[model samples]
Target chain A: MSITAPQGFVAAGVTAGLKPSGRADVALVRNLGPSMSAAAVFTSNRVFAAPVKWSRQAVADGQLQAVILNSGGANACTGPEGFADSAATASRVADRLGLITDNVAVCSTGLIGVRLPMDLLLAGVDDAAASLAPDGGPDAARAIMTTDTVPKEAVAEGAGWSIGGMAKGAGMLAPGLATMLVVLTTDAELPADALQGALREATRLSFDRADSDGCMSTNDTVILMSSGASGVTPGVAEFTASLTALCQDLARHLIADAEGAAHEIAIEVTGAASERDAELVGREIARSNLFKCAIFGGDPNWGRVLSAIGVTDAAFDADDLDVSFNGVMVCRAGQIGEPRDLVDLSGRHVRVTVDLHAGDRSATILTNDLTYDYVKENAEYST
Target chain B: MSITAPQGFVAAGVTAGLKPSGRADVALVRNLGPSMSAAAVFTSNRVFAAPVKWSRQAVADGQLQAVILNSGGANACTGPEGFADSAATASRVADRLGLITDNVAVCSTGLIGVRLPMDLLLAGVDDAAASLAPDGGPDAARAIMTTDTVPKEAVAEGAGWSIGGMAKGAGMLAPGLATMLVVLTTDAELPADALQGALREATRLSFDRADSDGCMSTNDTVILMSSGASGVTPGVAEFTASLTALCQDLARHLIADAEGAAHEIAIEVTGAASERDAELVGREIARSNLFKCAIFGGDPNWGRVLSAIGVTDAAFDADDLDVSFNGVMVCRAGQIGEPRDLVDLSGRHVRVTVDLHAGDRSATILTNDLTYDYVKENAEYST
Candidate 1:
């Protein structure tokens, strides 16, 4: 169970013959609720996909009846015609579900700058609506995968309600949200304003900190919808914390299943003047190809980490910085500390900690090591 | 002949027993001139190497009689002890040449966070001092090689005078200067201010635009010394232009020999609101791993290019962007134009031109395609 694990949500996955592999390529999640409230975040990249433009408008009213997603073409940089295609897709979904067009959101992912096969996609939507089921979340999660090896789903329990989410991403994961498509559903009673605030706060600490390849996508979107079936209105603060944890769980899944990744890295920056500084330092280190390569080689290269940190505008004294790989401090007070060989990097999970010695604020960024497989998968992606 | 091609310059190379491979690891370039006027630039990275710190102070008085460079250890993040080692190396060089310690600059390259073997380096300086000759530039160039495949040397002649230079760098090349050590000798009469001005201007247009791997090093340095032996003073503007061309020539060599590089890509962004904007756009595209991987696969994936451009803060209308690969207009006005198959990318060189259609400014960034070998080289570098 994923999104449909929550009450008042039904979903379906259908084969559209859009993907060359002929896998399930379309999914639909409908909100059947006493109250419908929704919130969403999209890729900050200026060159967004057609479906992103359509869905932005659809979610502007903070209420959505359904969401239709396809994983065949990104429909990005396809100009006005692509926008029209997205609008037509929303119209088809709305017609099949007997919902208003403005309340139907659309998402598309795959190769950028290509148009979707409109006929097959519309037919798939019709079939998905006809096959909608409360237990279809897992199948729906599998349909949105492009290069992902497995479907990602997570659930967080509340007193009388719950939040369930599914995400699809494999590459081009960067800050401002990874190259991903995510849908979250909750059975808790909440207003649109509360849902919107919670979603923003949750994503800021979750999706915005995952910088896999430093390539922000043109088709990233995350949606959260609530239905009043559970009739338990949780406190805004409590709801936001739960949502953040769930998003982080899904983000971890995205990285663990990242395209060609061999190691999942957590760069934690502590003793910063502010949370922003900590994040800036972590992101800079996360994006350093040299550091990533060093990790992949099973080398505790704290020098690369310091060099990466030196490039950022974050508040830190060069001479006071300390770095650790795993539990071994490789650099202390900016000098060689323990023997680098003492730190082991053979494991798939690696944690690099940086102490700025500036303040108490901290942040962590999730990333992957740069490996030959990563190069292979990305080099051969569009070819 | 490289730096020794200019009058009043003597250089030598010697094995220092520092490199594990038993290669020559020490290089000495000395100015035996009627006038000693020098200007130099160091890496902007705050976490600079000990040699960089030492050289900055040595050249602060607008004069330098000698520069000693060593490979196999960068002497970075070594704290006070490393600085002491650099100072001792300079003092040894100065004493061997019967000059003041302040007149000698030191440079180091290779793995960071390691101390140089002082005894071997000092003895090698003695050997280099005894072996210094007017034709020793090429030997000195070879000694500075860490990962560089060849000795880089160039000469540019002026009326009754000339400028000669040598450089060594193959990886960790990025904007604000590549991970390189450059020594330039000029026989023409000039003041330190003029040399500094010309050096700054030349490097701005040349080395600063070459971003091979986007990993800035902590040990980058460029030194320009004027001998004034020719008694000919060229106008500053003419000398600056010649110096720029010379630096550009060396920069090209660095890119052509970038570590594990398959193709040398020139990403030129034109019609921008300003030169800074043009460069910003070019660098953004040059650094996009997705775009670099696509290039390695010989795919004219203009979508990656557009997506890269969309993430920049440069002034450009997303819908008005145009991209061409090898003269084929694959994307026009931000949409598909000619068939992508029409673009050929079978050669070692690739030119990706983006027309922002916003203004008259332009810039070109040189980079290398991400390749399996790149991953292999960087992954195994420290190990």
Candidate 2:
């Protein structure tokens, strides 16, 4: 049971030679329910992809019957032709599924600015539609990967219902959906507005804090579709919690598979004036190449951590800050406290706690340490 | 003849036990001028080091008699005790030179948060002052390096006057002076206000455009001094051009010798709505790890270029942009223009040009590709 764990969803992934490796590069997810309720979040970058532009408009009505996702070529910066290609892809999906084009959402991820091989992409769409099955969720998850080392999926079981999700993408991932195509299916009887609220709230705490490289993608999208197949109406708050938990799981998965990352860093910024201030501080540390490299090298260079904090507007006294690496307090009252040797980072997971000592608000952000493999993979990614 | 090439200046470097390698770690530059005029710019980071806080105040009156610099200790996030270390270092230097401490500036680099060995530092100040020589510029330059592979020095000759400078720092360098220390000496008879204005103007085009790694340093500083020994007061524009040229030369040197850099990238952003917009675009591109890695791999991935542009506030029509790698126009009208293989990137230097098709404004930024050695050096730096 995967995305098909939900009662009314069918998904498929197919290969149409779009990828040189002949890997599955096309995926489709359809919600055949009494009601089609959905919510989606896209990249905030102004120079977005053609698929993003089209999906933004298509997702406006808060209803979606199906979503078509493709890898191998991101239809971004392809000008009007890219937009036309995405439109044609959606129209073809709608025609195959006997649904209107407006009810079909599209997502594409790969090298940007190159036109999709229209002939192959259109053919792949038909194959994806014909192969749709409840157990095709894993294939769909694998289809939209660009540089991801593995497929990512999450499931949360509720009373007589469940939420299933599939995601693809690893680096170049940040807030505002960052990078990737995430499709979640839930059979619970929740309203569209409720799904939107739950998604935003969940993602704000989950995916929004997953800042791997501080690079935001042009084609990032996260969509959730409700089929109401369970016939079990749950409180929006309960659903939101379950949904957030599932999203958080997938978010962590992305960090684990991040490019060239030797360590997964979880920075917890406590005692900020506000949540935004906490986020800003944590993100500054997450994005610091100095700190990231220190983590990669297994050095508890807390000075780089403190310096990264000093560059932000977060409310923290230079003389009163506290920093802990792993579980040892390396800095106390803004001065070196314990010997850095007391702390250990010889593991894949490293946690740094920075207490701003300003207020009670706090935020936790996840990032990956800079590594040699990340450089190798990205340097020759499109070659 | 670097710092001391200009008349009325003497420089010295001395060994201090601060660095484990026992390399020279203390440098002093003195002004023996008929007109003692000086100006300095410091990192705008909120968490600046003790020396930055001290020098910002000392140089405020624009009458610096000397600057004492040290490596192996950043003296950042060490709180009030750190500030005292900077103050005591200045006082010791001033006492030996028979001058007030307020007339002396200070700069420090290396591992942050560690208090400088005050005993070693103070003793080294005396040694540096006693050994002051007119030809000690190269030694002074070498004393302040951390991970730099070579010393960065530049000279520009003018009519009856010359400007000479030395710089240290690589990586974690960006605007607001990046993470570097620069000392520029001139024999021109310029007033403090003129020196300040000229320094700002020159740095706006030179040091400010060197955006390597996009990490701001708490100890970053660039100082300019006029000794009036040559007795020639060139026009402000001429002095600005000469100083800017010298700084630009050192800036290029910094990029060329940047740690773990396989390619030197000169990103030129043209057709922007404003110069600020152009700079924003260029800097965004310079900071993108994905884009930098592509350059390191010798991949002419212009799509990564567009993604970087999309994340900035720079005014540009996504549909009308053009990009060139090396000399090949890989993207035109925001679509694939030429085959990426048509371009070559085997050389040490590479250029990426972005045509926004928005307006006439343009700006250029210098950067280096993300390399494994960068990861290796930076990862193991603090360890």
Candidate 3:
């Protein structure tokens, strides 16, 4: 289920003095390529990290040979010096690998507005590039994590094609393009345009629907690189389906590790006029503090859900809306439907369904409940 | 100040067995008018309470004599039967006072999605109508409170003109058009159009900037009634000034009594491209859970503030932004500015200022921080 499962790809992760705990802090992935066609998606936040700026430009020509990531300092808002540090790190990796600097992408996640320890980061990049191996994907996954409770890695394999990805984020995780730092590798020989098109389409349903908190990050980057060394080119239809499944698996892992999360809740909005409408309604309900707290306390307070949905522009009659929580019909046609018991909420998963009764288009958003530990963890986070 | 400080109005509050606690649950206010003209603003929430629907229809003709309010239950989503209940309440009050049913306005605040206790509610309405008095404003204010630690009332006097108001809301509070049930009474000889114009202008700067928990209610209503019992008419300039001061006072009281709120934080956004931009930035910062929790923990985490503002479309560079928390310059031009100990945030007031470095337009939003008690209180909230 790791990136090594992808054909003609090798990955490695190691510690090079970036974090004091000696956990993996540097990860490298290489595409043993006959063709280097690739694509990437990054955060839309205007205040982006230096690594994001470099990777965004690197993917402009739609080709990539490798990706290097670290998880100790974001190197964001550190001025011109931070940008130079990111470029220098990429250059050092390219020099050691005898590859073009523009063909390498970089990502960093951790504290913001702090200068990266260049001496340590550059040395880490060299060590990571040297340690790259076909079975190093798990180590690479462990290296690109900050506050994530577990490493997130997913893989989808078929007869002639393979898809694999690793993601790391627990907070500041809302979507414009993607939520956090992610690297996806594949071996199917696909055009650059096709890869980019498939990445965007896959993210719209997967990473885009995982909202832990409403904060969007400044360093969210998702890179998809194709080695094209396996001599297998699946049809676009199968490639897209595999990509969707892979992204969904990765998104589920992200939510399961959301910071201080209690129950992982799935909010489904059905019978909306359009997919966009359904997403809007689902996300709105997912982000409501009242609804989240109710889930935390195990109360079937359907009024809060209806009120949250009613505020959105999604077309639906309040009287025609129906809501269910954990298989209990709490509200029907906007009125209290059936009386349900408020019992233990200790389970790790919960489900909420909303029937908009407008159209067939629907969307599902994943979120976590608000709990006391969530408030405590974030309240003193900066200290 | 209570509503009775205003000239030419009678108010009363009574208990008629609606609430199990036997507290004041019904209130009545009447204008002994030589002229009767009014204007009102209703909640933008599509699923509104029955009283909101009735008042919206009643105020269409721009004339009103009385307002009947109950605080034990919000008759929302009770279907056609709910509308019938609202009309019957108005009819009972109108019959007692020999006034037209259309001249009476109704407002209710409490739990949503439950039908009004018809027998108790009707009895309370009749009792409140009979107990109406010229000096019962304080009683009326006390009656329309649910989970509020204190009652909110404000009064302002002009040269022969006067204005007063009462508000009730402890949660489900946020910006647009105010997030609670409010009734403003004025004795100035003014038409409905002038009252509407002034009310909108005042609310934009006052009630519209208050955010308790970022949840907009399903029963928000702000009504302004002109008894015109006093023959003197203030000029537009003077009337607006008085209205602004009155609203400001009421807004302060509302924030002071916000449920489970320990501190009142004022977020000011200055040097924006436009007033709208300033308000947008201020509200964004105010509603950020991270920022609110930081204040609660007494940590001056200015990075959260910068990141929150950075996500908006406001025309300001991160490096050009300056932020101060509780008089400490924590960030300058998006970078860490000054080194100071985090101020004590255990007090009842907190302030955050953001300098956008764009223009002179500015705005301020008042809000309360997220605390443990807030979650506990809201988690147990049910009908």
Candidate 4:
């Protein structure tokens, strides 16, 4: 179950002739709510997609009754014609559901700078609206995938309410939101402001830390819709904590299934002067292609880690820094520590810990090693 | 002809049994000067090598007599003992040449976090000092090769004065200085202060814009020494211009010989509000792995370029951007323009020009395409 795991929600996935593979390419999620409350976040890239511009306005009033998402065309860098296409898509979805156009959101992902096939998309919307069902969560999740190998979904239960989420992303995963599309739903009575705050905080901790590659996308969007069918008003802290956990679970799934990834690595930075510094250090290491390549070769080359850290503005003494691969401290006091041969990197999971020896703050960044498969997949992706 | 192409320079190359391949790995350049005016620049990375730390002080007084460079082991992240080793190497060079220890600088390149074999390095320095001759520039150039496929050398003539340089770097080529070791010898009559100003400006326009892999190194150094043997005091502008051209020539060689690179790409950003903004846009595009991969695959994917520009804080209207590949305008007004098939990337040189249409400022960044061999080389580098 994905968005439909929450009560008072229905979803549908339909085949659209937008992809050459003839796979399902359109998904529709409807909230049969006693009350409509919503919040959303979009890619920070200035040159964003048409669907992102449309959804930004649709959710501005903090009310959304339905969402329509499609894969096979990002509809980005297409100018005014693309924006018009997005508006028409939402309008069609709203008309089919007997709802206002402004209460419908749209999302798109795939090749950029291309116009969406409007006729096929519109027909798929009609099919999806007619096929909406309470058990269509998994189908909806699968329809939003581009290069993702598997569908991702997660849930968190509260006192008498629950939250569910689904995410789709593979390559082009970075901060300012990954090249991804995510939809979340909760069957709890909550104000739009509270939901917005919780979503922002949760995404900051989850999606923001999952930097598979240092490439930000132009068509990323994450939307949350709440239906008051559960009628349970939990404490603000409780809701935010549960939402963060659920988002993290979904984020891990995204990294685990990232395109051509052979290993899932976590770079944890501790003993920093501030949380921001810790994050900066971890992000720098995550973005170091040299470090990632060394990890792929199963070589605990901590020198690359030190070189990456030296490029950041984080507070730390070069001579006091320490780095450990897995459980073996390979570098201490900026010099050789334990024998590098003692570390093992043959597993699919690896952890690199760095002690900055600055303060007590800490942060972790999730990333994947740079391998030939990564280059092959990305080189042949758009072609 | 390389560094010794100038009138008052002698150089030598020697093997120290440090490299497993039994290749020459030690270089020495001596200034036979009437006036020893010198200036230099090192890597901006805080976690620099021991040789960098030692050379910083050696050239601090605006004067130097000789430089000792070694490949096969970069004395970086090697603690206090590494510093001692650098000082000892410099002292040995000074002793052999009958100069003060403070006037001799050292440079090292290769695998980081490893200590140099002091016994071999010191012995090699003695051999290099004894072998120094006026026509040994090419030998010195070949000795500093780590992964470089060819020696890079350039000479700029100005009346009776001339400047000659030799550089060695291949993989860790990025801004903050490409993981390079460069020695420049000039027979012009100039003060240390003038050489310093000219070197900084020349490098800012050349080496600073060459970002191959976006992985800065722990050991990058460039030194310019004046022998004052030409007895010609040319205008400062003429000398600066020649130096800039010479540096740009060497920078191009570094990019052309970059590790596993199939194409040398020049990302030029024009019509920017400021030169800084143009560089910011160009560098961001140069650092995008997706853009690099697309170039390697010979795909005219202009969307990746737009997406990269969108991430920067540069001044540009989303709808006003235009991108051209090899003079074929593939994107105009932020949308598809000419047929992408009209652009061909079968050559070794690719020119990607992005028009921001914001103002009149322009800049260019040199980079290389991402390839499978690149990942392979870096992945198996340390092992």
| lDDT (10s digit) by residue, model 2, range A78-135 | 8888899999999999999999999999999988867899999999999999999989
The model with the greater DockQ, 1 or 3, is: 1
lDDT at residue A164 of model 2 (Cα atoms): 97
Query: Candidate 1, after superposition: displacement of residue B201 in Å?
Result: 1.2
Residues B63-118, model 4: lDDT tens digits = 99999999999999998999999999999999999999999999999989889999
After TM-score superposition, what is the CA distance of residue A12 in candidate 4 from its true location, in Å?
0.8
lDDT of 4 at B296: 88
What docking grade does candidate 3 earn?
A: medium
In candidate 1, list every pair of residues with a backbone clash: none
- TM-score per prediction, in order, is 0.99, 0.97, 0.96, 0.99
Over 4 Å off, model 3 = A20-22, A342-346, B340-346
Query: Which ranges in model 2 have alpha carbons more than 4 Å from their true place?
Result: none
lDDT of 3 at A163: 85
Better of 3 and 4 by lDDT: 4
> How well does each candidate reproduce the native contacts, as fnat?
0.80, 0.85, 0.47, 0.76
Candidate order by decreasing TM-score: 4, 1, 2, 3
Q: Please provide, for model 4 over A1-383, each residue's C-alpha lDDT reduced to its tens digit, 9 standing for 90 to 100.
A: 87898899999988988988899999999999987999999999998999999999999999999999999999999888999999999999989999999999999999998899999999999999999999999999999988888999998999899998989999889998877999999998898999999999999999999999899999899999999889998888899999999998988998898877888999999999999999999999998888888888888989999999999889999999999999899999999899999999999999999999999999999999988888888888781
**Against the unseen true structure, what C-alpha lDDT does each candidate score?**
0.93, 0.89, 0.84, 0.93
Worst 10 residues of 2 chain B by lDDT: B170-179
For model 3, residues A216-281, the per-residue Cα lDDT tens digits are 777889999998866898888789889988998899999899877888999999999999989999
User: lDDT for model 2, on a 0 to 1 scale?
Assistant: 0.89
* lDDT per residue as tens, model 2, B230-337: 999999999998998898999999888887888989999999999999999999899888899999888888888888888887788787889999879999988889
